[model samples]
Target: MMAISVTQHAHLLASRALGWLHTHRERGALPPGCTAELAEPDTVYKPLGETGLAASLVLREAVAGSTELRLARELLDFGWKQLGGGSMLHERLLRYPMMSDPLETYAHYARCGYRHEPLELLLRHTTSLHSTRAAEVLPNRRLAVANAARISGFDRGEDGDEGPRTGSTGGTDWAGLTAATWLGALPEPWLIDWLTAYSMTHTVFHITDWGRLPERLPDDIVRHVGRWLPVWIDIWAEIGEWDLVAELLIVDNCLPEPLGDAAVWERLAGIQHEDGLMPRDGHPVTGDDQERFAAHHHSTVVAAVAGTLAVSRTLGTR
Candidate 1:
């Protein structure tokens, strides 16, 4: 049989995966737990919380301007409708947590040209969290907040100094965060477990634009991550950590140049079901529809986003 190129297969997988998501949207799709709560015909409610919604929206942006733009648009519409008063986005804003997800979600939508009053409110809401809740924000989340601010065209001060203050407390120290998060104290990338490693990767991606803008990451940190990325990818892929592997694919793309690991891409593409569900990890779960969807949705969403991004990069070079 003739082999399909990684880009072509990615396109195929993305198309099929998105189709599966759409087909199953009301059934087993939309995170099984949220299906009932999210069944409201007019809006997409993320019962699982902002992360799934964030990933779905990011997937939309990844596929934007491509042949899959229809799916992208559909998701955008669903998400936009959910931003009204008392919606998931709104509720998250009122709580005033230090998490950066709501900011990143809106920023991704903004990058796709869907700006509106509610999104701005969300951004403003996140900006406020910098000062009002500085102590609660962790280093990785601080990077997310900064990136969201950058992408949304909101100034986060020299280091979010403009945020509200709590007496003697200060804002998130951007320089200090950079100094502490990567390399200097953390274990080698290969030695770290998956989730923490993912956070570190996220720190790099947010700060450095996935290596596209290396200046975002210090020279030492960039060199460090770039040097060890291959080993990380090999290790994760061998263990069938499809989600991490796909994320590593993104990390590879953010490098100074594409890493061009067609084999790794193909291995990721190979494991995808014909219907396009990529299991979150090596072990496949079997059960009721909701149970199964909950187990696999995040990884499937990551695959779609990753595939779309890989295709975009491949085409950009060609």
Candidate 2:
């Protein structure tokens, strides 16, 4: 078998790093400054993480208008059927804490094919994920209503658990960040469908609860979330997923403004070693620095530099 290219190797390493992060989180072994909680056994699983949410928000902001609205409607129709009919894990999905943009939500629902029955069922199922009555109830209810209104308006026939139609159940099976990018790729008509599917799986579990989590979250939720984070990040970076690229850029941009620090840029720049390799760990170096000039010539380092530059330029443009 042909050896993996330097770029591929870098991505592999990055995936490992992300896996480590996820493992640490799931095990409740995060060092500090990170917060995630476990899921409740009785509750459903949703995959919405901060990174995913941020990416979604950015996508929504970047592509807004009638084209997107129409796409959202189409997606909502498909997503509701897939989710509520039990083809997808609807119950385990976590609802967004804050109400999603109303227009976006409506667009998503309009595209989802399920009518009031499944929509209502999804709302109820999602609502039950919360351990406490007061915790996520209101937000869930609101989302349910918003989603219902959107789908209800578009429902043209009897609504029930319609299984996947013939030749309708095949597509790429990208998980984590890879899946996120696919959603980002959809045109306006399909965006909501992708988002609806995404929201169900993009949750970030809190490893520890500081009086904020529901009364009964499963112990493994945090670990699972942490284990998946690094992999997702690596996939996002490797695939040139501009959604995540924009998110990182936004974060880097915001960091400097709030802290009055240019060091953040310098730090990111510094990660490039003199040889061009971007090691998963070790000291930070720049691609052009002389102290490690020889290092820049290495193929692996060069590939890393390319990835770093890609990320940097994306951020710079934003």
Candidate 3:
């Protein structure tokens, strides 16, 4: 069979996602964020938390950039409601600086029974694990190392020292690197570095937790996992490595850009079913037999298709 070019494959994927979105809009099943009421609240107002708001922002910014005038109006109105309502939902939204002003957000979150100290503690514990140091050294820190160690099956050693011994296994070192990268993106970057590192290490090692981690897993960690992992294959491909394509695909569509390489586009084109659904590999890691893995028939497929198309289109523009 002749090889399909990257541009052509991307167009096909974009067409598929656009068609699906159109059908969904027509059926009134489109996300609430895309609705006409996104700006105006009626009796059907649903309060999206910070993460949901962020997702809406990404979608609006990326796919709906042309509809900014409409989205902006809704977003402003939504912001007003969140600020005025004084509800717990709105309060949680305030905890996120990206959602609103930090001081005001924290005040609301505090009023709504949210504690800031715990977040601090979580970060400290995470940092200790990443550094392979004792949490006691940072006496004020709320250590969650025991919890993390439990998840990874590591032992809590004497005198509050837990996890792999010094240079015992390089896995923790890689995990620490991932964690540090993640923590470095936080508001109090140094304090939260540990929590960020812990979450990244956990996600990479515990593949099943890929999409299950809370969105607040340190901004840097989220950004790295969200952005870098998907394009990892592209980095490898640029150096003439095609073998990583399948592994990359497992996490590709999770990001905003799914089409990282010509091979990825080709694989997507081959695997798409006649019913317009992409199958998923039952296992998170499909060892060796990449072709045997199934396309995910869920919303992930729709997002992946759209992202692939968008990346393809952007590449064409360049």
Best by TM-score: 1
- Which sections of candidate 1 miss by over 4 Å? 1-4, 27-67, 85-88, 95-101, 116-130, 157-175, 183-186, 209-215
Question: For residues 1-318, could you state the per-residue lDDT of candidate 2 as single tens digits?
Answer: 111232233233222222222222222212233222223311111211211222222233332234433433333333343333432232233333223222223233333333344434554433333232233432223333323332324211122313222222222121222223322233232233323323322221110011112122233433332343344434445543433322232322222121112322234334433322334334354454333333322222223222322232233322
Report the C-alpha lDDT of model 1 over 221-280, residue by residue, as the tens digit: 657777888898899888888888877877766665556677887777788888777787
Q: Per-residue lDDT tens digits of candidate 3, residues 84-131?
A: 433432333334312212222222233223334543233233323434
34 Cα displacement, candidate 3 (Å): 19
- lDDT sort, best first: 1, 3, 2
Residues forming the 10-long window of minimal summed lDDT in candidate 3: 137-146
Q: Which stretches of candidate 3 lie over 4 Å from their true place?
A: 1-4, 21-178, 181-260, 282-318
For all candidates in order, the CA lDDT equals 0.60, 0.28, 0.35
lDDT of 2 at 56: 26
Q: Estimate each model's TM-score.
A: 0.75, 0.24, 0.31
For candidate 2, what is the TM-score? 0.24
Ranking by TM-score: 1, 3, 2
User: Whole-model lDDT, candidate 3?
Assistant: 0.35
